[model samples]
Target: MAITGTSSFSVNSSPVFRRDVTSASGNLKRNLDLKRFAVSSEQATTSSTTTKKFVENGRMWKKSGEESETARRVNVEESERNGKSLKDYFDEAKDLIRSDAAPPRWFSPLESGSHTRDSPLLLFLPGIDGVGLGLTTQHQRLGQIFEIWCLHIPVEDRTSFADLVKLVERTVRLENHRLPNRPIYLVGESLGACIALAVAAHVPDVDLVLILANPATSFSKSQLQPLIPILKLLPDQIPFSLPYILRLLEGDPLRMAADNLVKGLAPEPTFGKLSHDLLTMSSYLSVVADILPKETFLWKLELFRLASAYANSRLHAVKAETLILSSGRDQLLPSQEEGEKLRLALPKCQTRRFDDSGHFLFLEDGVDLVTVIKGAGFYRRGKYIDYVSDYMPPTPSEFKKIHESNRLIYLATGPVLLSTLEDGKIVRGLAGIPSEGPVLFVSYHMLLGLELYPLVTQFMIESNILLRGIAHPMAFKRLKDGKLPELSTFDTFRMMGAVPVSAANFYKLLSSKSHVLLYPGGMREVLHRKGEEYKLFWPEQSEFVRMAARFGAKIIPFGAVGEDDIAELVFDYNDQMKIPYFKSIIEEATNGVINVRTDASGEVANQQMHWPYFVPKVPGRFYYHFGKPIETEGRKHELRDREKSHELYLQVKSEVEKSLAYLKKKRERDPYRKMLPRLVYQATNGFTSEVPTFEP
Candidate 1:
């Protein structure tokens, strides 16, 4: 077929293809042309290659081919001697393919350069497309650590969903037999994900861990079900066009075409020239075009049927531990609901939602998916481990580095004044903090959360305790491009033993008897707008109070003030929202991930609001005060009562507010609070300036 600028597949020729292609814009047609050109070029190169033939010992021999008949007979004898028959070799090949008549194929590893016997077997099942080539990016990265096996179903294999399940079962059984002791991970994306879950359910004895990405189990019930009738009407020999299908799939066509064009011209495309999504989609389309034939009507129908057939009933039989990676922006299925349903049905299940991704989340966000997989302990050595004890405590070297950074910050931002209650009286310099126990420091997050450096480092210096900070979920999440933002605070947060804020993580930390830091105000307090400094945007519910009571933990309410002095807010929420692009970006970032600020007047209305614009001012001193530890040891019974628990929650909020008010009032008394005075004192006394403290 000639590569054409416009897709030759007539919209009216096949009703199914027509309905599907109705969404395809002119951009999609151009993309298809590019893909076809690439394929045609590859075919041309292959066809041009000549095979050398020669006669060796009265037998025909090819220079670029295998050994002669005598050599083959000797090899056969050697194989038979080793208890191997032709059927054994045939069966081995069949394991990778559907049948004996099928073309010979082998599982392609993620990495082709190296082979490690100890690597875990990761079987990847493709989505409805059945191309099995969309995960090239994943394969490239994961193959380095895993024995990646992507199943390539033949285009002509029109097996029913049940038979497909059997095929997967057989493959898994063979792999299990080959590596009896080693762990096997079955990874499925979209349609393949549903198949993987079904296979897991059928083969109860086969020890397998499932990693499902945007499973299509809910597709039949989703908004896409309306398209099934149209798909069924498609002709048997409907023309295949990658761009047309991608556009129908709601993928960005123009960008994909542009990216493919760049790749075709340049072996290595420059990063940042094209958006990551465009590049990923382009690569996916290229693979799909290469593997799938033009007439995909039957395959499409089969996929739809399979999606409809695999209901929640089958999911109940899945005994293996499953990790569902749901995409919030999934165009093909109801990923979030499907994931939740699957989680409920499975005995052991964990769900993670990628809010920024679509149906091709695995292809677009491969690195982040890998990180989550590793974190979940899905790909471990030998047997599967239930829990991943991967939390790294702050090392001595990290402590030293943090201490040095803290000192520098203190010098730059002015002396950090620390105060706490001692014997019902105000005391200075961190004397009130307890030396041990499950201490939970509930603090108001300062603007940009800069207070963390002084608070955590000073406590470490004084008490020799590394505080495990409960941070925002954003701190642990990778960006939309499957890579961590350069110079992001995430690295710092992780190195300092900061875990993403979750009830489970909190409980784990408390149960382990570790010092934990929590900010009930969360992102709202840190990214507060102008005139909102030191304001507590704490939630009304007192869930943490009950949790603290359960662990009998010491809850110390603390607060900090200095953000107003350091910088002036130039743009508030209203100002930022006025910019259409900025507002859209914010919406995109938080869409389906978390609820954004909705109320305008409520205390927690703007709690989800972030992105405050600020300009630096004269450097100012930071002040912190930790209230008397509220011992929940004997208050476990009171926590059971909602009223009492809420009262306790209010009390903590009040204490944090009180600490902020006290700091604001008393900071005026500090001699070093003003820059000129401290500068003169420093100039006169060098490093030995005796700054006067406030009197109680």
Candidate 2:
């Protein structure tokens, strides 16, 4: 019978084979060939020449001088006993098949020089014609790495559907009995795949069930329509049609086996077997030049039924590990969507499809088959991604990869100048700030304390900088009412590595990575009793002298200029008369008064603690400048040579004054400038100017 189609190539038509004009065998080889079936003469000769490949009989016939006759006989007897045991096992296997208790017997490759067992037992179930010589030498070679078991079902030309199912059940039971404790896997092709699935359902021991080119539905009355016209014709008209049907009967040893034949076809070149099977319901198997889906209404109907059945069946919920390979180019069964639906139904199963391959994915992409099988235990497809859109846990490996790929970043709030620029474009010192030393943060304490939060959060979280602040004892201690203020929580400051140093421990803090953010002006600058605000108080000279001698670390004189202009203090401190006991305790703790003179020689000794002062400028803006670090490490402890340290400290203060002047000018041109017009009106309305004690 001749099958003329693009799928079947004529080797003789090529230049390499033009010179060979051969006989029937040669003609068959040249015109149509399963090329892998051809074996070399040398290999055939070598195989034929070998009677027993191993020295199995050597122990029975050993050297005479090596041992006594009785001992030699005992060893020979033991060897023969082992051989008999192997023969007995094979006999039992064959008997099991004859009695319909098991499928066909499979031979495992012996462990020898070339035959190494790497993979486990992989049982293959064939459709129709049980086992054929179509398998190539390469297939056998692969067996050296993995044990191959080919299953043969008990369905002949006349078997019914019920009988086929019984055969499958018996075969599964036999397999379980034979490999009682061992794990075995299944890979089924075409109708054979259907039988395997059935067997797998009955056998809980089966590790995996691989279905290849399986139909979407059973090929019974409706799908057999394509063969109807040809069946009406006699054997002489199309002799091969009846034989093909007989072959399909062999496939029916299990339910739905015959159905696999109808759904396997797809138009893609790689899926040629399936495509060819659908086109010609004749003896020949080859691709048709043109395909017409309209000609096979029965095939389509059967497929739709099969797909629906599989979807509705309990088999979809089978616990056996499954991997479904869909054909992207499948012309049969609406491959992509069907595969997707199947995957969704079987959420735990893995699904993969090839755009280049079709229904016969195993044949065209067998190399990938090895990989998929090896990875089956770990494979999980259609995994949900948790991206605020879904509920899935983030993978640790993915998190690590993202973390490694991201660059380290540091962000600071309020672009402030650290040093003057050569071109006069303020060189922002955020990135350039030295991370290693003791940094005393001297800044203006803005009213309402709103500016400090961003500064603190950014310093600790965004920038790698530790902070220490010399807060007032009043700020750190719990309120007299037994409740802690929100800002005074130790937990908040501890997370940021902030240490609130008392006046006694101020030196330790200033010596560490202690960035002491302090406002020397304190409450004196903050108080704008009746008519004064936005002005710096006449700072006590002792406040500057005491801070300098306390730490050998650099004194970073800084300021925060804007805030007081927002609200003027309209009331006096006496308005909220303190409880006498609380007032007495505070006064006792602070020494003579709440605020007292630190030095008698300094100009600030003349300033009274209750006096208040105010700024004459418009209440529009304020600024703070961070002067260079003052080197107080070399200074002595004596109050006599405090003159030199005082002179250097005054330089830092002058630099701060210069920065404040620059900021005032900057405020004039700055687009973000705003004024609290109400504070301006109150300041103009003769608000009182009074001072309260601030013990920072």
The numbered model that scores best in lDDT is: 1
Candidate 1 weakest lDDT stretch, 10 residues: 14-23
> Cα lDDT of model 2 overall?
0.38
* Clashing pairs for predicted structure model 1, backbone only: 110-139
List per-prediction Cα lDDT, in the order shown: 0.60, 0.38
Poorest stretch of ten by lDDT in candidate 2: 385-394
**Model 1: number of clashes?**
1
Separately for all candidates shown, the number of backbone clashes (residues 3 or more apart, or on different chains) is 1, 11
Query: What's the lDDT for residue 258 in model 1?
Result: 57
**Which candidate gets the maximum TM-score versus the true structure?**
1
Error of 1 at 130 (Å): 37
Per-residue lDDT of 434-522 in model 1, one digit per residue for the tens? Answer: 76658888878888887887776666665566677887656644233222222233555665567766677878777766678888777
